[model samples]
Target: MSKINHFKGVLFDLDGTLLDTIGDITYAINSALIVVGAEPITTSQCKGLVGRGLKNALKGALELKNREVTPSQLEELVPQMLGSYHRHPYRHTHPYEGVEALLDDLAKEGIALGVLSNKADSLVQPIIRGVLPTHSFVFIRGDKEGWPSKPEPDGVYAFSEAVGVPVDQLLLVGDSEVDYYTAEAAQVDVAIATWGFRSRERLLEAGCRNLYSSVEELRKEVFPWL
Candidate 1:
């Protein structure tokens, strides 16, 4: 493997990547489903539904319920779903173990960090600022009207531009296949976090060659290079 310092900047995926917001998300979606008279899904099902953005998550919920809801109907349902989610955003949310220390170490090393998330911009910023206050992040990309969400590379490119770094020097760290594919599309190096949402086999199938089983492993394999 190349030395850790070889990477100049790192981009992170928010949901399932840096923090576990599953509880809030699952509750919100399930509540929406129930209110809309669709079947409610379990937290386990919700976890798999995540990472593709709120709209996709809702679609997954409908799929699980075996209900066919129109896109227009799903759109109408989004506001209430998100409102319920924001009400208890941090109720059961927390960083994965060792994330804080690893972030601290990276900050101390003067590495540039950024976040790109399918999470709406409204939510991504506060969640990150609330969770990791000490370290300075170069940029963050959240859902904006009409902006393509991941597995597309636009957000990655935006973050790279904001950080004034080439995509080649950027490393994307995320916990899902969406993150891996986004990095691949953007032509950046990637690290799949096993500590997040997806399984090791799934990550491998998604074409993620670099995998970190723990935050400490990330610190060892990636921090030194940054």
Candidate 2:
């Protein structure tokens, strides 16, 4: 294996990277679709729609059913979706296999950890707290007002500053092209976790080379010292 660059901090993408949140996300999307009288989407379909943000996912869900939602219409529907999701965020969501252990090990190794996700801040904090309450993240930020979402470098930059780590000394671990682009724009190392939402083929086509098929593989390769 090639030598992995040492990182002082690691910023993880929440939805797919750390947690298997598709069940709740899909539920939210379908709830909004129902409010708009559109047919619900399957989990697989929802997978392709996520990674940008909930608004974009809702818009894509509408498009899948040949329904084009106006901005005003979407504005009305978003609350219903968010409300439904909030009611049952943890009903189906949980940390991915080995994720809790990995986080624990990383913490023990003195690695600063944070979460930077495109999911709404309201949802992100609660979900992380509910699912992985034991781990204390240095920073947990999501899509909030005045903060640009990822694939843009703003979130990553903010995370680096918040964690007191330079961009080059940080690693962004995620599961989508959006995450790959976010790391690229921020000039940080990125490790793509294929066990999440996107397939290895899709991630590779997005120019992601450091692909980890499993959490253990990621630990062994990226933090071999642990």
Q: Which stretches of candidate 2 lie over 4 Å from their true place?
A: 1-5
Q: For model 1, what is the alpha-carbon lDDT of residue 12?
A: 84
Give the lDDT of residue 167 in candidate 1: 81
CA lDDT of each candidate?
A: 0.81, 0.89
**Candidate 1 TM-score versus the reference:** 0.93
| Residue 23 displacement in candidate 1 (angstroms) | 0.6
Tens-place lDDT digits, model 1, residues 1-226: 2334667688888777788888888888887888678877887788888887887898889888988878898888888788987777767888888877777767677768888888888888777777777768888779888888889899888887787888888888999988878878988888889887788988888677788898888877776553
How close is every model to the real structure, measured as TM-score? 0.93, 0.96
Off by over 4 Å in 1: 1-3
lDDT, candidate 1, at 39: 77
